[model samples]
Target: MPDFQKIPSNDVIDTLLKRVSVRKFTDEQISDETLDLILKTSFRAPTSSNIQAYSVVVVRDQEKLDALAAASGGQRHVAQAPVFLAFCADISRIEDALVRNGHSIDSNNLETGLVSAIDAALVGMSAYLVADSLGIKGVMIGGARNKPHEVAHILGLPQRVFCVFGMSLGWPAEAPAQKPRMDYDGLVHFEQYGKSRSGADAKKVVDDYDVALAEHYRGQGRQTTDASWSDDMDKKFHPWLRDDLRERLKELGFDFR
Candidate 1:
């Protein structure tokens, strides 16, 4: 049972706690004014060194949306959503500034990639939350990385820019139950990481979460084996995500070597 007394009544916390990735949406189009507001709010998200090295391409054309849906592993929600935003980690602009100033980046390093991607992610989360405040809901499509070259071709992205991910947005048709997350005790370590991940403590938390999530799934009539969270984790790492991402990045002029 949850302790209602401990739950804060702040509106922001309430919105975040209830937030779920909404896949189904109504036909109503989001107004331009509202979209602008969301954009402004999302831009307020902090960027690394204030470089703000990210770009969001607002796509609404039906043909382009359909193509994006196909690129994103045939996700029908991407095609049907009122809007799709392709968030790209862009350093091309910075590269140009460097050339004019007689200095150059030392072949794209890990830190370059990290900062740009982080910039896009911060903005994306802020956008999602702000949009949710206006009753808009959406899902982030990480499948955009499945064919990064194709996505770039479709979006007309320049060099030093790549899609970190895409998002499909609209007014939701109905609310979906929020999914369970890992326990705070297991996730939050004291002074250093992995200190809390002892054999006994890790198993205890994972086992407890497995039972809780299994019960949650059963309540929703989802068929699966016992202790499903571990099974889910196994499946996640077995195939790995976008194994070709490194090659694709190098091809796009990013020397992550």
Candidate 2:
């Protein structure tokens, strides 16, 4: 286990800086009170017009969790975590309300879709922060979109309520090493977008990161062979290996138009 010093002040900036994604979890259950607090924290996130166009489905049933695991590309963490939450971009509630008030809303509108997705992401980030504050570990499972339709069916989500992602929370079995980030000078600009660095310079930085990551994983007893971040990213970028989430989103009533 890695020793992490507690930040006494509990300042939001310090808390955010210390948070890391935890994939491996211990065999322990999260208490109902903790779960409630996490959900309530999520609900407090700022929303566009306070529409709060999002909802969460908590998966506790073993069979349902198993199905979700399958939908999430067989990530065992989905089933192993004490709490599995599917954060949704929900336009359905707003549409229903509009109908009841004698106004019709189109689910295909670009603005509506964007707002729902924004709400879901904000709420999910809040949940992660809350979990970290309580010493609980979590991982965001973007892999849940590998089979979005199947995930929606499993969760019994209504039309216009799409699964944006899933989050798994529990006590971590081990602490993961801090992943290296790109140099701030390379990423951040004062006002406008900056000119790109030379390819050689970029490659050198990425190669260094690859070495750092491989060593970090090796220290944790995980196997990895890529000598650079670019190599691993290239392997993951194949079109065939990627899921057609855009089409899935369209089917869930989001309009790219």
Candidate 1 deviant stretches above 4 angstroms: 1-7, 194-200
Write model 1 residue lDDT over 116-226, tens digit each, in one string: 999999999999999998899999989898899999998999889999999999999977777788788788787876566453377788998998888888878898778
lDDT of 2: 0.82
Give lDDT tens digits, candidate 2, residues 120-139: 99999999888888889989
Query: Candidate 2 regions off by >4 Å?
Result: 1-9, 101-103, 195-208, 221-227, 240-243
Candidate 1, residue 165: the lDDT equals 94
- Candidate 1 clashing pairs? none
TM-scores for all predictions: 0.92, 0.85
Q: 69, model 1: CA deviation in Å? A: 1.1
